[model samples]
Target: MATFQRHRAFPWLLLLPQLAIVAIFFFWPAFQALRRSFYVQDAFGLGERFVGLSNYVAVLTSALWQQALVNTLLFSASVALGAMSIALLLATLADRVLRGAKGYRTLLIWPYAVAPAAAGVLWLFLFDPSLGIISRALGSLGIHWNQRLNGGQAMLLVIIASVWQQMSYNFIFFLAGLQSIPASLLESAAIDGAGPWRRFWTITFPLLSPTTFFLLVMNTIYAFFETFGTIDTTTGGGPNNATTTLVYKIYQDGIVGLDLGGSSAQSVILMVLVGLLTLIQFRYVERRVQYY
Candidate 1:
């Protein structure tokens, strides 16, 4: 009995530290945020009341919240789609056409190495209205590039910046997926007189389904949460809150505005949205992932 107990306890002993840390840092804070969400805050910083659901109701019913939510979803979707599609195209090209692809691979992964804030700042300079190369070029073509005045243009800039930053990660994963495919299969397809396009559609794409599934989950989560730095640095969710995302709104509310309850409610909503997406992805995509 002692020997069995010792064996059983060994794994727990190893995991105890990590479990303790998670409970302390993650769960404790989460519980606190939940509790805070039930309370109300006033402007003078002198009033805090336990209003239970009022804050949530206010936030959910607000027009600004609705607008922000839509903007967030649109921006994230565009950036993920743009980055993943470009990365897949580049990966396919590299795998099939290019000899000595190391240089191109290095260039592709460079953007992923950059910090999000830095990437945002870099993109800001690139699109700056005065004395900016891109702006000047657009001006020469009679296209006035004013991100401040046009909300659609501002959103487009944010999406482009985000996609540029994320393309490297997508590229690396797709490249790895491509490299993992067996060369013998391609050789067999060639022997059968299959054209490149035919082989790619019939064999390559089906095998790449697993990689696509993984990328979709990760990219969705990233778009939903981690694009905040880019938004904050570049747009500050600005131009009359045109670029305000859900995560950005949460930050503005909780940290900047000190509307703890409203912020927490927003957070909980965001969490629920992400959870639903993850669940759907697992349910629909897991079975479809092809393993060779």
Candidate 2:
């Protein structure tokens, strides 16, 4: 009995390191953020005071925060949809290619290795109004291109940069999902006189639902948090705070503005928002996500 119990506990023992890492890194910082949310810290970190819900109320009531929230939602939705749609299309095409498929897949996946900041900088150079090739081309066409000053243009640039950076990651997943669908099933559907579009809608698309749902959740989170580097490098949350997202606002307030309590409160709120969003996806969206 003792030996059997020891063996039963062996797996948990092996997992202990990972469990400790999670607790120390993820849970500990989260706890600190929660604790700090209720306390106002002096700018120099020399003093602090318990302010309770005032920080939360201030963040929630602030007009700037409200704008940031809206921007975050719009940015997240656009990036998720744009990246996933393009990725799915590319993956489908790649899967159908009999020749150079490996090379094509490698090219599609290479962009994922580029750092987010690097991706942002690359796009920025391409869109630089004065000297960029694309910008110069647009200039000749009489459509002035200056993202630095135009709020809409800045937002659009950031969205494009984000989508470009994320598309590769989504492509890999979509390609794998596409490849996983049994060829025999598609062959059978084709033999039944189903056209390419009909076959895709009736078979491929439905079968990819699980992967699509998963990517939706991940891409949403990526847009909310991971795009910080891209926005920082490209727009810096930009002209008149047009592209200021919730994550960017948190960094600007907490790290740059030195409003520790308010930022912590914002962080806590963001955590709750992400948690709720994920829960909603899993609870409702999962029903439609067909798993093979």
Question: If scored against the real structure, what TM-score would every candidate get?
Answer: 0.94, 0.96
lDDT of 2 at 71: 94
Any runs in candidate 2 off by more than 4 Å, and if so which? Answer: 1-4, 7-9
Evaluated at residue 167, the lDDT of candidate 1 is 86
Candidate 1 weakest lDDT stretch, 10 residues: 39-48
- Over the full model, what C-alpha lDDT does candidate 2 score relative to the true structure? 0.94
Quantify all predictions' global Cα lDDT against the true fold.
0.87, 0.94
Per-residue lDDT of model 1, residues 1-292, tens digit only? 7776769878898999999999999889888778878887675658788998887899889999999989988988898899999999999988765676888889889999899999888888888888568878998999998777778878988899999988889999999998998999999999999999998888888899889888888888888888999988888898899999999999998889977789988888888888998999899878988877
| Deviation (Å) of 101 in candidate 2 | 1.2
lDDT of 1: 0.87
